[model samples]
Target: MSGSVAFADTTFIRYPRPAAKVDSHLDYVNELLTEALAFSPRKYQLLPSKATMQQGRAVHEMKNGTGEVDLLWSMSTDEREKNLIAIKIPIDKGLLGWRTPFVISENRQMFKAIKTLRDIENYSAGQELDWPDVKILENNGLKVEKANSYEALFSMLEAGRFDYFPRSVMEIWKEQEVHASKNLIISQDIALHYPAAYYFFVAPAKRQFAEDLTNGLEILIRNGQFERLFLKYHQSSIQKAGLKQRTVLELQNPFLNPANMPLSRTELWFKP
Candidate 1:
C-alpha cells in the first residue's frame, strides 16, 4: 500500500526554498524514508503542512489514524515515546544539547558574572509552552517562563519578562540574525549543556513505516551519507558556536527515556 509522510512547517526545520527547493534536513530524512521503502512493494509521498509544534503533536496523536500529519522531529521524552513510534536515531547529531543564551543586547553584561548552573538558577529562562526543554530546565532547579509562540519568546526576554533564553548552538546565530531588531545578543561567557536527542516520530498506527525509516537511516549511517549531510548543513554553525571557548554548565535531562539511552549510541551522536 502506498502512503504519505507529512512534516510540520516550522522555522526550526523548514527553510526558505531555494531555486532547487531543497531543505537539507527535510530532504535528508525524505531520502532515508525513500531508500527505506525502496525494498518494499509500496511507494510513499511527502506531504508538507503548516503546523505549529503543538498542532503537529496533536495531529500525530490522533487515535483515529486520520490525522493530516504523520511525522514529527522533536526531542524525545518518556511520555512522548510511549505515545508514538520513535525512530530513535538522533537527527542533529546532539547539536540540540549544546545551548547558548540569548538576551537583550542591553543586558549582555549581566550574563558575564553567571559562571555556574547555580548562578543561572537565580535568573528566569524562557521557552515555548509545549517544549520539553521547559521541564528539563525546571527539573534542574531553574525557573522558566513559557511563551505561546517562537517569536514571542524573544519579545518576552526583551521586555525583561525573563532573564534569558537558551537556544541550541546550531540555531542561536541564525535566530539572532532574524531578531536583530530586538537587540538580541548571544552570551559569550557560558554554554549550557545536557544530553538531548531530537528523533523522528511516526504515528502509532504507522509501525511498519517507522521500521522502514529506521532501517534506511542505519543504511545511510553505514555508508557515511548521514555525516556528509549533517556536516554540509551544520559545519559553519558549529564553528561559530565556539563551544570550546565557553565555560560549560552541564545539567541532567530528567525527561530522557531510559529505553532510548541515547548516550550509549556514540555513532548516532555528535561530540562537538
Candidate 2:
C-alpha cells in the first residue's frame, strides 16, 4: 500500500513583478525556475510579489532584506553577487549578453555601417538606467540614451530619441511582435557581444534556499534536463536571430568578475 509523504513545510519562493508591463509572456527564466524547483526534495511554491518594483528598487530590497520577494533573476554583476546569494548557474546560458539591435527601417543602413566598436559609438544606445548593461556600454566608451521605464525605451526609439535599441536574441522577436505597428526591425548586419551570466539571485539571508536552487539546477544539468529544456525554448530563437550572419563586435563587462564566470562548463552557453 502506498501512502502520501509530507514535507516539514513548503517554502514559498516569491519573486518580484515588474513595475510596468515588460512582456506579454514570461521569459524562459520563469519556466526554468518552475522546472528546477519541481525537482527539489522539499516542497516549494513559486509565487509573484503583489508589490510592483523596478529593477533597481527590487535589487535594493533584496539587498537590504526589506521585501518579501525571496529571489529574482538578472544578469550577474560583481556588486549584485556581493550583496545577494547568487546561484552562479547561467539560467539563460549567457544569452542575455548577446545583443541584436532594433533600428527603424530607414536607419537600418546606419547599423549596417557599424563594423567595429568605434563605429558603434557614433550612434547612441538606449537602455534602462538601472540595467548593468548601461555601465558595460559606458565602460566601453559608448554613448547611451537612458530611459526611466521599459515601455518608454521603445517609444523613445520610435520618436528618434535614440539611434538604436539593442536587445538579447532571446528577447528581440517577442518585443518586435509587441510593437509590430512600429517600423523597427532587428538589425541582422551587426551584433554586440559581451560575456555575461544571468543568475537567480536569492535575497539576503536566504542562503539555504539559494543552495537548494543551485543543487536542483546541478541535478537538472547532470541528467541533461537543463540542456533539453533550454533548447526547447531557445533553439528556434537562436536560429532565427541569424547570429552567425552578423558581424560580431565584442564589448567588455567591467562590472562582472571574469574569474566568477562558469565558462569551463561550456555546455551552459550558446556557442554561436
Candidate 3:
C-alpha cells in the first residue's frame, strides 16, 4: 500500500477544514507519486499526520528528525531556512497570489478595541512564542503573551488570560463562525501580510524520491490537472473572497522564476 501525504493543520490559508480531508496538495502528491511508482516501482507512501506546530520548539522537533512523519505540507519560508532537508512543493496560485488581513482576538470576547499596532500597547498580545510578528507588536510596547498551541491560547483567552491574538483573516472567518458564540472577533486594521504559498517539507532521508515526486507534480500542474482539481473543491464565495481582483499566478511553467513562487525570506509563526 502506498503511504499518504503528511499534513499539519493550518486552519486558515492552507488547510481549511472543508479542504482538509481532500486537499489539493495531497492530490498533487498522490498524482505525482503514482507516476513515480509506475516507473520505479518504489513501495513508497505519502503519510499524512495531524501534527500541529504552533511554535518553533514543535517545528524544531519535527524538522530535527524526531517526528513520526515523512513530510510536512504548507510550511513557511522561515521553516525552510531552519532545515534545508525540507523539500519544497509547488504551491497553487490561489495561495501565491493573495494576502489577507491580520486579526486580533481573545477568548469569550473578541478584541476589536485595538485598531493599530500602536493601539495594542495598552493590551496584551498573545501569539506563538518567539514569533517574528511579535516584534512588531512589542516594538510599540504591547504586552505579548507566548503560547505553545492554539488550544492553549484559546484556553487562556477564555480564562481572561490574554487581551488579543494576531491571526489571518481567513482563519478568523472560518474559525470564528464555528467558535462564534465563543466571542472571537477580528480587527479592522491590517497588522502583517504574507504570501499564501503552502509547501510540503520532505524528509532528507527520502530526498531522491521526493525530488522525483516533485517532477511529476510539475508535470500535472503544467497539464492543468492541478487547477481542475482545485476548482472542483473551491467554494465560489470563498474563492471569490480569497481572490478578489488579485493576480492568480499559474505555477505551471518550468521556466517560471523563483520570484514567481511568492517566495519570501522572512521569519513566520502561526497564531498560537
RMSD of each: 5.9, 2.8, 9.7
Give the per-residue lDDT of model 2 (tens digit) for 195-255: 8998889997777778778888998899998898888887888999888888999998889
Q: Give candidate 1's whole-model lDDT.
A: 0.73
Q: lDDT tens digits, residues 1-272, model 1?
A: 12223223211112112211222255555665556555543445555544433633453443236554567777778777777777878888878889999988888787677778998788899998878899899999999999876767878998999988999977776677767688688978889999888788777777666676677778778888878877876788889888898889999998885556666778878876
Q: Indicate which candidate wins on lDDT.
A: 2
The better candidate by lDDT, 2 or 3, is 2
TM-score pick, better of 1 and 2: 2
The Cα local distance difference test for each model comes to 0.73, 0.84, 0.45
lDDT of 3 by residue, 44-75 (tens): 54444455333354345445655444455543
Q: Which stretches of candidate 3 lie over 4 Å from their true place?
A: 1-43, 48-67, 89-122, 130-143, 188-191, 195-197, 228-272
TM-score of 2: 0.93
The TM-score obtained by model 3 is 0.56
Clashes of each: 0, 0, 7
At residue 150, candidate 1 shows an lDDT of 70
Which scores better on lDDT, 1 or 3? 1
Ranking, TM-score, top scorer first: 2, 1, 3
